[model samples]
Target: MTTESIAGATVSTQANVYFDGKCVSHSLTLADGTKKSVGVVLPSTLTFNTGAAEVMECVAGGCEYKLAGSDAWQTSGPGDKFSIPANSSFDIRVDQAYHYICHFA
Candidate 1:
């Protein structure tokens, strides 16, 4: 797949703070002005709430996740992507470093 660059976008390095430092994301706006975050999660299990719909692509390592309302835990690896609904939450378990790009919709 081809990747498009987000031209003239600003990068924010601040942690979301909700994860209590377990996750840190760098935010950038795409050429079309869509905001996205690329982040790495240290080896830890954490829960996160989302304000918008998200498509999370595993860029390097991977993690297992249990989406809200679901009891099944799914595994995603490099190039794998998962969708989370808006105003929802999910649980993620990382045994090793997990890198991902989160596209907000």
Candidate 2:
């Protein structure tokens, strides 16, 4: 791999793309891809394998999650972190505007 400098800070960018509906995107291959979001709405469905994620909120909003086959959704709001288990996927729903971060490992 190669390294570069940006704005007097050493940072890395592997040419990841931010989805049209999402605010941030990252390509971390250590376990799984990592994605960080801010002021954007994401898809309701997500699947992760061999990894998990930590969700953080800057401007908190209502967030919901559910298993693929389940009809009920687990909900959260402001200052909450949702754990996405490996080998299992989840669906997320948001109510109101928010700024948040998602780190996958």
Candidate 3:
């Protein structure tokens, strides 16, 4: 899989980015190939502010997930998943980052 920066408006002066994943080449010749299959895995402790949220799909492994408040969390293992809409935050452990794999669907 491949990751690319989305470009458009430039409200900010700078940005910091990083990528990590595994991928395979697309079949067929480049001249005739339509697209390739790829996936992404973001395994890390992510902190969102008061008005921030993210949507992620679990492709593999087990991850411990928790919301900003309350005292309960769910495990995203294999097909198990969740979505963090806008204006919410979640805290994940470092170990949770490992064993996450995404693929072209």
Candidate 4:
């Protein structure tokens, strides 16, 4: 399989694209075999549900997010990160393309 590097980690290129191309991501396995994804989100407002806890690190650009059970929205930009609990959902709004690394655990 083809490999690519992100956040200093080398990972495979195979991945699943979603939301009618609004989002594209590559699946990766860490040295410890932990699964994660690195992706780009085009300008849009999207809601997502998580089955596992996720740490989303903004690689480029920025977005605003409203976490589950919270009405306040927070903004995150390049070099910033946010966390989502398992079995939760969040709303994200982007005015420009946003790049991020999502670590699942």
Candidate 5:
């Protein structure tokens, strides 16, 4: 199931914009100190490096991703998720706005 809402989270008002506004997100900290980010990627292709393991949970729309050192491209849609290892990277292509939650592990 997809996560619809988060309660008792400390949200940073400022948005983290990347790729010249192709992607934007707001940082969030749960009561237990779990880190997360709610974001949307506009129609574009982008590469992202991970500092920690991440679970990309799709909340709306979709995106196709190719992990570093892999030739296969995978699709992720609403309610779907994909994992990226720490210190890894992934390339994402979006034809439409892709909404997601980045869950740090």
Candidate 6:
């Protein structure tokens, strides 16, 4: 399901801005210490490297993504999800605003 709200989370007020403001997010820590982030990528192509494994959950809008070592670009829209390995990277092509939740695994 699409995450509409994050309950019992301690949110960091300062935004994590990247790519000269093309992308931004706020870090969140749940009561049990699970880490997550809610962010948006504006219209641009950007590469993101992960420190931890992640499940990318789409909440609004969409993006085309090409995972590391892959040639195909896949589409992710509202309610869609994708996974990326730890210490890996992925390329995202955003045609419009792509809203997402990054769930650390």
Model 2 accuracy (lDDT, Cα): 0.47
Lowest-sum lDDT 10-residue window in model 4: 1-10
Clashing pairs in 5: none
Which of candidates 1 and 2 is the stronger one according to lDDT? 1
Q: Write model 6 residue lDDT over 2-104, tens digit each, in one string.
A: 7788899999999999999999999999999999999999999999999999999999999999999999999999999999999999999999899999999
Better of 3 and 5 by lDDT: 5
Candidate 4 residue 46 C-alpha distance from true site, Å: 0.4
Q: Candidates sorted by TM-score, descending order?
A: 5, 6, 4, 1, 2, 3
Q: Name model 6 segments beyond 4 Å from true.
A: none
Better of 4 and 5 by lDDT: 5
TM-score list, all predictions: 0.86, 0.48, 0.44, 0.87, 0.97, 0.97
lDDT of 2 at 75: 69
Roughly what TM-score does model 3 have, to 2 decimal places?
A: 0.44
**lDDT, model 6:** 0.96
**Over the stretch 7-100, how does candidate 1's per-residue lDDT look in tens digits?**
5777775655446667887888767778888888888999988899999888888899999999999998888899999999999999997788
For model 1, name the residue pairs that clash.
none
Please provide, for model 5 over 1-105, each residue's C-alpha lDDT reduced to its tens digit, 9 standing for 90 to 100.
Answer: 778888999999999999999999999999999999999999999999999999999999999999999999999999999999999999999999899999999
Tens digit of lDDT per residue, candidate 4, span 6-105?
5555667676677887888988776777888989889899998999999998888889999999999999988888999999999999898888889897
State each model's CA lDDT, in order: 0.84, 0.47, 0.43, 0.85, 0.96, 0.96
Model 1 ranges off by over 4 Å: 1-8, 13-18
Model 3: weakest 10-residue lDDT segment is 22-31
Q: What lDDT is obtained when candidate 1 is compared to the true structure? A: 0.84
Would you list the clashing residue pairs of candidate 4?
A: none
lDDT score of residue 101 within candidate 2: 45
Distance from true position, residue 23, model 5, in Å? 0.5
Clashing pairs in 6: none
